[model samples]
Target: MSEQNLSSLTNIPSTEVAHENYLLAKLILEIQQTPDEYLPNLLQIVRLFRESVTMKPVSSDAWVKAMDGIKNPHPVKKAVQQIALSELLRKWEEDGDEEEQTETAEILCQNLEENPVSI
Candidate 1:
């Protein structure tokens, strides 16, 4: 990741997955602004999902399913992405930080209509 990309990532660290996905959509839209990359974005998405399990602490089966979703980038990818994005949105709504709320809504409104999560 270039300095620009790192700066971009640092600029927003969502407490939940929907906001992460929303921010990621924004990142994709302006991808040309950063270095051409691969796993950084994907990795970030997966990382966001993983963090959700930590935040929620569900059953072992659920945890495994979540991990499995990203561990292999196959049929579960879309589902996992949606789950993560859903979490992000939930957190955004519950978040008390005014800065976070505005940021999350702005990102979500900007991308949700187009992205649709495919799942």
Candidate 2:
């Protein structure tokens, strides 16, 4: 699939974010069956989830629910999530829209405060 299509898939409607979580779970199962084909798409979906979480255009709960579908072990999952969030924040700081930059910074601060990561 084209990068445009992959990006579009990540942009789930806010109202349908719950449905996206279900879809993500199914995708995870599919990836296990066809890793070579599905892995890239799965990573794209995860990037979209990270964008959703950082951008805060959708419910944070929905983003968290979508992340729950990642099949990695607990520590790895946590680390990956943290890394995604950090990278998004860094990217936003560098080049995001001014309004979104402020909003994302606030959300990132709140998340960090609420869920401190252990090294």
Candidate 3:
């Protein structure tokens, strides 16, 4: 995978992606069921699917930058960066919830304005 674009590799057309949607979900469940020793490999596969779905290009740019900043480079930054990236991906997934909450808040504001609370 060196020098290969992971995002492009998993970028299936939307039509084809629809067909694989269920398969992808099932694969996620299977990965959970898979034994511990095999998880690292399975996770890499999951990362590919995540990149494809998010349409975000995944790269080691953050890790590379972190390493460059360190006077004594260690592979620990790689692990740290991966964890940071995973948390970021989770945030991206949850971003839709913010929109829903904003809408609900606006509706509440409208209701409150129409029926102002009396002290």
Which candidate number would show the highest lDDT if scored against the true structure? 2
Which residue runs does candidate 2 get wrong by more than 4 Å?
Answer: 1-73, 111-119
Per-residue CA lDDT of model 3 for 2-57, tens digit only, reads: 21333343455646566566456445555556999988888898799888898855
* Greater-TM-score candidate between 1 and 3: 1
Better-scoring candidate (lDDT), 1 or 3? 1
* Candidate 1: clashing pairs of residues: 16-88, 17-88, 18-85, 18-88
Error of 1 at 25 (Å): 38
lDDT of 2 by residue, 1-119 (tens): 45455446556564656776647655655565665877788789889998888884758897787776554347877788879978977887788799987887789789979986455
- The candidate 3 region of ten consecutive residues with least summed lDDT is 1-10
Q: Model 3, which residues run further than 4 Å from truth? A: 1-29, 56-119
**TM-score per candidate, chains pooled:** 0.30, 0.31, 0.23
Compared with the true structure, what per-residue lDDT tens digits does model 1 show for residues 1-119?
A: 56566556645656634686757656665664556586598669768988887796579999899887656557666677768978987886786588978886788788978765443
**Comparing 2 and 3 on TM-score, the stronger one:** 2
**Each model's lDDT:** 0.69, 0.70, 0.65
- Ranked by lDDT from best down, the candidates are 2, 1, 3
In angstroms, give how far residue 87 of model 1 lies from its true place: 1.7
